[model samples]
Target: MINLFDTAKRILNPFFAKRHLLGDDNLFSINNILSKTAALAFIRAIDKGIKEKIEKLKDIDWTKDNTLPNFPKSFLDEYGLEDKPILLKKNIIEKNKLNHPDITEEEARRIIGNALYKPETILKANPNKPAYHNFISRTDDKHSDIVLLELSDEKENYEVINYHIINNPARDRKVNIHKKS
Candidate 1:
């Protein structure tokens, strides 16, 4: 007689198995688009903008043609990513400061390049603290995804914190933090 458990798995196996039908390279490509380093860069740019009271993310001229931003030659050389088209946003948040007071472009890019890849979710958003920027990053799927909140001070920048991989980061993720663009 056929076992009941075996029969059920046989019927359900096709559905789950189909998910991995694509080759490994395809999966890698998808992940590359949301590279942890890219996310780190994205967060750093935002932090710099907010610290300098720029507030609006859209206003920053991060991309010329919705493509990569122009990076400094020193940054490119230090990272050994000269061939890579990806670069950090150029405009400084503050007109007075040529660069952000907190982190250098090189340090920011390196932080992105070195961040660990891990998926996370926004557990909380706090706008009450006028002196600090607070948010929590966590994932129900794994404990490894937990990350500390990003504070307003330069010392608590996301670059220094462990990077988080947010899968469905709808526009609402940072909605409360930034004013409407």
Candidate 2:
């Protein structure tokens, strides 16, 4: 078996040499090489952990808990709607779960609920579909969850048409800026 430590050293050696030669104080400081190397290793480890978690999620038997959860009364009250069953369909769950293997059913529910309660951004009367509104909420540093709600002709009924995770570099940059604050 290949030694990971040796492989990593081989890979990083060139990068370290280039950084040391370039001598860019802000971007790559030779004086901070040890710290930078440690930070990079930590980031890689976290990324690997996330990938393993996602793989575990993909293997889960979704059928074990196929029951659709109902939107809470508080969620209904926020939109000034009567307390009625507005459940997420199994097909939607299946589709989203397949699309975003990194997100669990409970995490998906929490993301949707959080978006409905306090969305970071809302695109009302979306150009593509005037009846559908997009609610975006940042889930983590790397992912943002979007919930699309379609208003019925009567304007009283709101149905969630779609929910999915998005990984946009620009969006992540904005999120990172906010996180810094």
Candidate 3:
């Protein structure tokens, strides 16, 4: 479980770590440049990783009966130092079918499609719309906090299972809408 930023810093900081790289008059300026450079590098790495995950998911053979795949460890790993594997909530899928069988397939495809991009895409393209929703709650006994992405909305408040995050302050949240009986 490598911390992504920590790893990036370790790799990139040497450019700024040596005293020779810093200007005597303005150490603050040098530090700023180092931080910005490191941040950009980290973001690019993350974006690349996310794209890989999306491509992998796109390659799966989907069918009416086929179960959705779990989010790959490489992608979810961005969230934390530990492996934060994503679990697809089959029950929510079932409930979605029950609530609106007519639109279930379309919505499911929408989720898969919309999930292919970085969160920033939603932020820039559709600021008013939710970037994420709680499509499926993760159910790992070891990890209580699992991020469920809400991709799109269906009419009839079908998006209730979907929690908003894009423009909303709840962007950092991990939602578990399921109530244990």
Candidate 4:
């Protein structure tokens, strides 16, 4: 019920939180930086008295203040944030499970075998490959760049979920299909 997003916006924006430490003028993609920047805001909220804004947001007697800007009505009242404290740590954990089922034990793997992030790696020596031919592509090649195939983690710590990949316009993307035996 606490406008985590508004909280995020507050924490992430230097102009909002009035902290230049969050500033990174060198970064051209402010939008991209904001997403990553918001994560820190989430952390900051927990460490400080963001409870007031979070509380006021969560309290938001929607039955009364049901107008303008995010007008919290249905969800806020339903979650009972108007009546209780909501710790995101507990909520995010449980919510993740309800979101999806993990890949089955037998079907899953503990460790990722040899993986290829061809873009991050050294270009293969093959002279005539298409990767070497394009002028625009050569300037910013992701072929050898590491594409997080399998992330290493501790023990059985895994979760089920869904994801979608949005390709970088600068990088070439293609699906590899294998033929049936």
Model 3 lDDT at residue 79: 33
lDDT (CA) per prediction: 0.33, 0.55, 0.39, 0.27
| All-Cα superposition RMSD per candidate | 17.8, 15.4, 13.2, 19.5
TM-score: model 1 vs. ground truth: 0.20
Arranged by lDDT with the best first, the candidates are 2, 3, 1, 4
Candidate 1 lDDT, 1-181, residue by residue in tens: 2333333333334443566533336653323333556545655553454333222223334333112232233333432333333212233223212333554434333323322111122333345643322223233332222222233333312211222333335324554444422
Residues 1-181, candidate 3: write the lDDT tens digits.
3344554554444455554554536655344555656766766776576566555544433222223343434333443223322333455556656654654444444445344233222221223444343332222233211124433324212122321113222332322122110
| TM-score of each predicted structure versus truth | 0.20, 0.43, 0.35, 0.17
Candidate 4: TM-score? 0.17
Candidate 4, 78-116: lDDT as tens digits: 323232222222333244335424523121111011011
Better of 3 and 4 by lDDT: 3
Q: After superposition, which runs of candidate 2 have C-alpha atoms over 4 Å from their true positions? A: 1-85, 140-142, 168-181
Cα error of candidate 1 at position 62, Å: 14
Model 2 over residues 110-141: C-alpha lDDT tens digits? 66665554456665534556667666777777
Clashing pairs in 2: none
In candidate 4, the residue pairs with backbone N, CA or C atoms under 3 Å apart (3 or more residues apart, or in different chains) clash, namely 118-143, 118-144, 119-142, 119-143, 119-144, 119-145, 120-144, 120-145, 121-144
Candidate 3 regions exceeding 4 Å error are 1-31, 35-39, 59-81, 100-181
Cα TM-score of candidate 3: 0.35
